[model samples]
Target: MQQKGGAAPSLFRNGFLQTILLSNVLLQIGIWVRNFAILLYVSETTAKDPYAISLISVAEFAPIFVFSFIGGTFADRWRPKRTMVWCDLLSAVSVFAVLLTIHFGSWHFVYLVTFISAILSQFSQPSGMRLFKRHVPEEQLQQGMALFQSMMAIFMVLGPMLGTFVYSTFGLETSIAVMGVVFLLSALVLVRLPKDEQEPRTEEGKGQFRREFVEGFRYVWHSPVLRMLGAAFILAGLAVGVAQALGLFVVTERLGKTEEFLQYMLMVNGAAMLIGGGIVAVFAKRVAPQILLAIGMVVGAVCTILVGYSTSVPVTLVVQFVNGLVFPCIHIGISTMILQWSHASIVGRVNGVLNPMFVGMMVVSMSLAGPLKDAFSLVSIYVGSGLLFLFGALMMIPIMGHKAPEKAQAAAPAPAAVRTEP
Candidate 1:
């Protein structure tokens, strides 16, 4: 399926691509439902303390911060499908365990379950990325990635509403148990994929798993493109994280909100993401890779700033629409470029390295936003987030000089001294 001369694969024939798109839809749907409800569950079940609620969010991501780099490296080393299946199975098991613990135990057990789920899920990202490249032709990467992201957006738009309904009627334990089943469903679909779709990378160590895992970190650190992207990932994530954390407060306080109207705005933003993703899938192949990276960051950053600048909810909604529009391009484009840029062996390590960069940004923003909201205006937080986006744009500069592997080799100049004079 690999295309020469930098051509990407056409999307129609990629079975793995189709399988992932379908599986991710279900996986994300379950995730969206769980994500929205988990915090509320933590607060209600755990005596309603705000700090404990904060921990709910932090606990889910805390392990990702610690394990992401290793996850990425391991992703490269292992068969993506195998790794992915195991992750999903473990996630399902963890959730089921929580249900059992909750039957016998305290509400705090729910929080612990959420944390374990987060750790299991981190491995799936790198695994999926590696798997995609195997069955996908290089030319269709943009469309393929777009299709993947669009599914997540589709689920996000619906997941919260569904979660609310399910939780209200079914109660928390039943809803969570269902979410656990969703992971098993994903695992079932994943099992259908070919085992060999995992791209082979040079294994660094002949000895123990720990040593091999550590080598994954070293491999990623050595690659300049990955190193730079790691930094950019952190910065871009911070801006987005701040905006996400402050969303409800900003909507209710500064801009008066009708509940129905807020829902409409969310719909608009989610639709924009789907639309943007589709557009990127079709048109991105013709664009320069570097330009795609820069444009996505620049537009995403600008939309963020505008979302805060105006007081009108409608205007803010428009900005969010624009933000959604710009976001997929950045996500899909950067992902496409980064995956293309790295070699197979180190894919896991590269992703693992990326873990800290993004997790650091998000952890800082979510933890600090509440205190900062107390100290400074939410508008200032928004504005500060915008400035962070500008920093993300600056990070895109290093994306410019990347040449395809063959092209780089082809472009190397022959020595003049080696040729005899005529």
Candidate 2:
């Protein structure tokens, strides 16, 4: 869909958006069911063995680190629509395979359901980004990202409930079956996406995979905007990781509430996210992504400090709500900026290179947060996290006036996408 004159294309009318959003909804249903069902089943079957429980988490997350770049490289080389469809189909096939294995007294094999899907998603997610870059008008990128994030926010509030209800009411076998079915449906929904444009072939195929992967890094390093964003990603990851690790402490030690109260805080945050997403989507065209990102980080810094320092329940909750509200800005702005700054052909690789920066640093900081907590006061840790947020905001300053660069020619290398000015 193309923009007419200066008017943005109708997002709801766009076939890509319609299909992808519906596919994502089905995907979310399957994912949450798989997540909660597996967790509960593993807990009961293993008698809540700590190692077994930890292994479940490892199965879900480890693949992101291992296969992200590899998957991204393939996504760039492959047709995005086909890649996404195959990933979902494979995920469904794996889930059903796990279900069958469970029936034969091999219940421990259930971890493969999470592991395989997680690995496939590394391939699938980047392909979706590639499709997004190819299909979405640059003017509507932020709005589209906001809308997508808002749907995820809705899931954050409802997903656990839905998963728990299904597992509790229907048992493990049925939950697994449901997950398989949902994934199948998501694959079907994706069939409605517009056909992928055929690229002209030359005697030489898309460059060597290894060479392209290395170029992804070089691409980010050379772009002043992307370079700053990478640094921001690291700082933001560190800040978020520490805050996430210590959030329970804020609920208990600071607010003098039990651990269960954390759910209520999450609920408030989720509700605020829905509202924030709406606000951002409405005003998307008015603000540049860098400014939006910087503002979000600054607000996050203030809220982080307040949440740590507040002793009153209402005050802490309010700060938590505000934090939830602006959280979408951070995500939407980042996604929009990446799409705007990178060439369409290299979107997958750029996402692959950047996502790991955030997730890897977050994981490292999360591990360190425990040790830091042992040595420092909770308030002090919160203040430090806030400082990290401030630093992340400062990283945006260099790119504040930048606009989306002109789309590079399909044959251009990654670095050719870089534009020195707005």
Candidate 2 lDDT (Cα, 0 to 1): 0.86
Q: Local distance difference test, per candidate?
A: 0.71, 0.86
Q: RMSD to native for every prediction?
A: 5.9, 3.1
Summarize candidate 1's per-residue lDDT along 372-422 as a digit string, tens digits. Answer: 889987767777887777777677677576664532112222112111122
Q: Candidate 2, after superposition: displacement of residue 155 in Å?
A: 0.5
The candidate scoring highest on TM-score is 2
Q: Pick the lDDT winner.
A: 2
RMSD of 2: 3.1
How displaced is residue 188 in candidate 2, in Å?
Answer: 0.5
